[model samples]
Target: MPSSAMPASRTDLDQQPPAAITAAGLRKSYGDKTVLDGIDLHIPAGSVFALLGPNGAGKTTAVKILSTLVSADGGTARVAGHDLAADPQSVRAAIGVTGQFSAVDGLITGEENMLLMADLHHLPRREGRRVAAELLERFDLADAATKPASTYSGGMKRRLDIAMTLVGTPSIIFLDEPTTGLDPRSRQNMWQIVRELVAGGTTVFLTTQYLEEADELADRVAVLNDGRIAAHGTAEELKRLVPGGHVRLRFTDPTAYRSAASALRDVTRHDEALALQLPSDGSQRDLRAVLDRLDAAGVEADELTVHTPDLDDVFFALTGGTTVPHQAEEASR
Candidate 1:
């Protein structure tokens, strides 16, 4: 529960870095439908934070408001040491947003798209080209700098979109479903880019439906459901919230399995596989306890593996197994 608020002045901020973003009682609604209900967010600088939800879960709405694309009806927010409402221009200056959809101009070359972003940032002509070239090279788009973005693959387009966002060198960037339609390899490539960004002290706030992506890249994640935060924590902590966790003991010898099953007293036995499954939280202490008891009873397992509920399980459990139309909408795009 550390504060994410930096001091009022940049000089003071240098001594103590505050949270890049902090919000309390952030509310937004459309007509009678509430999109965010008194939500709170605290994002630290230089870390990757993910917000997860199904279609129409208000993930998009939250991003819109935070990025200054939309105004919230109620609440207070601070971004990069500037109050969101009081100084929206400063907020806009300090952050970049790359939505789920590609923003590249299909008619223009990739480098032109980057230069356009530089122009939007108001950099001088020469400086704009320099920044654009650096970002293009950094994002591996140097080869296709002059190629029209329409010719690029889905992954390449997404990379170009992110590179454009960095033109202003914003301290924090919002990536809404950046890798949604990409293949496995492309998705992995995006993840590595995010890692490199954070390593260089850039704060990333991305929204995604891919559970594995969040688990792999995020230092912290929050599950948004029905206009509220259902759960928020590290991947392991969220996984522990669900119930399907166990330690499995497999044996080649039926007699040893049976002996262990008898000694264990409370376990599901698989006669065909000669395995005994004991409910566990998949914690080291729980695993150690199981091992010690087996040793005391002289039961030897041929193989042992710990199984814990993954992020998908946590997502389903927290979001009530609801599928939304937004996913379909994203697909058709």
Candidate 2:
């Protein structure tokens, strides 16, 4: 990746942007169920922060509270430098929200939908038209602007939905599973849109059940489980928390394989395949150690591959095997 497109490092404390959103001990409950027990967050400006979880894990609830659409039972939060409780109007003014479901009005033309959002933000008539026109073209909706939203495909509707959200020019946006029902190609397009938003200095708070989406887009990720934060860090940091990393060595000669299997201190053997799996963190040092051991044994492997735990491994380990819903499953819903 180019340096310009690289995300700011979390460890660069001195260069950290001001907090776009901050909450401490935030709690919420609906009737007998506690949606959020006590969650704390500090998201930096111009960064993409993703909240991930299984179904009913309070990801949406967290977005709702931070966006000022719902009130928290306890704790305090500040969004866009305004207290969520004492200055909700200001918070609303500085932010935009796109929920899990499409908010596009099928009865109205796409242009009309954009105009409606412009009106909601209280832009002047002429300015509203200009903004709407510009955004329509930006999202490649110009040709379909006059058509009713209902006539558009799933991808077009999603694009229009985001275009409407940008009408207010909000510095912060809360996206609650924005790509849930999108096809793979459409999802990639949406990811590009998110990248552009952050590149232009917008802070995005995203919630999703798609682990790969979080891994791809988020500068920092927080995994929510059972109404609390299970883990929060960069994708790499979270992956390191899981312990299934290893190095695999395959040999064409059975004799070489046996020599390696005997020389290695601890290995999982695959006798039929003539392979040995050695425990490793997949670091360069670990790899070097394994190579040294192979040299000592006077054995050479035909193929060597490093295997490191990914987000799926981290998610399963952190959430106790609760699987993230796949795209097919989400589309069915």
Candidate 3:
């Protein structure tokens, strides 16, 4: 976390391409079933990019193809400056992956798992020991380092899983539904770790079923539907794409409510609740203007609330209810 410890080369991590990851016209199929139909992705280094979709939406398929665990039937992909097909070894060397399930070997101690990952990375014995120790400490697994992974709590196991993924010092990582099944507190812990990784110049490719997770963590997000990108943008940008955004104003008395509703002719009334809803783009200027109008009319709302369409609205609007089937599949996974 030391500012001076930052790498000098990290400054260029943002502007370069093939980027940390790049996929163009990527296609995949199993037998006659098309898993990925000409998908495209571009994730800059040192940024968190969330790939969101319900089950069978090709989220895992895309992750596998990019991670070199499965070959793409068509198209091109580059990971950390290496072409996935032609130089898979190089790609393997440059990135790490934590899949949807816990890959931690239950029989082994937490420290052993970290050391195992170091060995896979082909680090020297002395260096591997150093890295394992450092990672165990960093992930707060030091106390349980000597305990079998099976003895770790759900959250502890998850921390160890991610810690193992970092043993190789990968600059780019793929986290497939990394927080799946974790409790809220554990999920938040994982989010903090992800932020720390990106802050240290590690690009994160995250796939998750939780819409709010993506909204909270991703610098940019792409919602995949039926193996194709339905939409992609920053969280706020995606939110803005959905309509029905409004501002609600509540008055203490019926008189005040009537005055405000009459002053705003186009407002929708909720007479029983003593509230009125005015259509708004959900912008600060619009809010100020609305309040100014009420003030000039000698009216004031006792309480105010802003409502904007969230990702749920965006998902339903774009893909109908197909995400339900997809989520069912993820839960199974």
Clashes of each: 1, 0, 1
lDDT of each: 0.88, 0.89, 0.86
- Candidate 3 segments whose C-alpha is farther than 4 A from its true place: 1-18, 251-259, 263-265, 272-274, 283-304, 321-333
The predictions' CA RMSDs to the true structure, in order, are 7.0, 7.2, 7.6
Tens digits of per-residue lDDT, candidate 1, 54-84, equal 8999999999988888999899989898998
Clashes of 2: 0
Q: Write the per-residue lDDT of candidate 2 for residues 125-151, one digit (tens) a residue.
A: 999999999999999999999999999
TM-score of each: 0.87, 0.85, 0.83
Q: Can you tell me which runs of candidate 2 are displaced by over 4 Å?
A: 1-12, 251-263, 271-274, 283-285, 288-303, 321-333
What lDDT does model 1 reach? 0.88
Model 3, poorest ten-residue lDDT window? 324-333
Q: After superposition, how far is residue 315 of candidate 3 from its true place, in Å?
A: 3.0
- Give me the runs in candidate 1 sitting further than 4 Å from their true place: 1-17, 253-255, 321-333
**Best-fitting candidate, scored by TM-score:** 1
Worst 10 residues of 2 by lDDT: 324-333
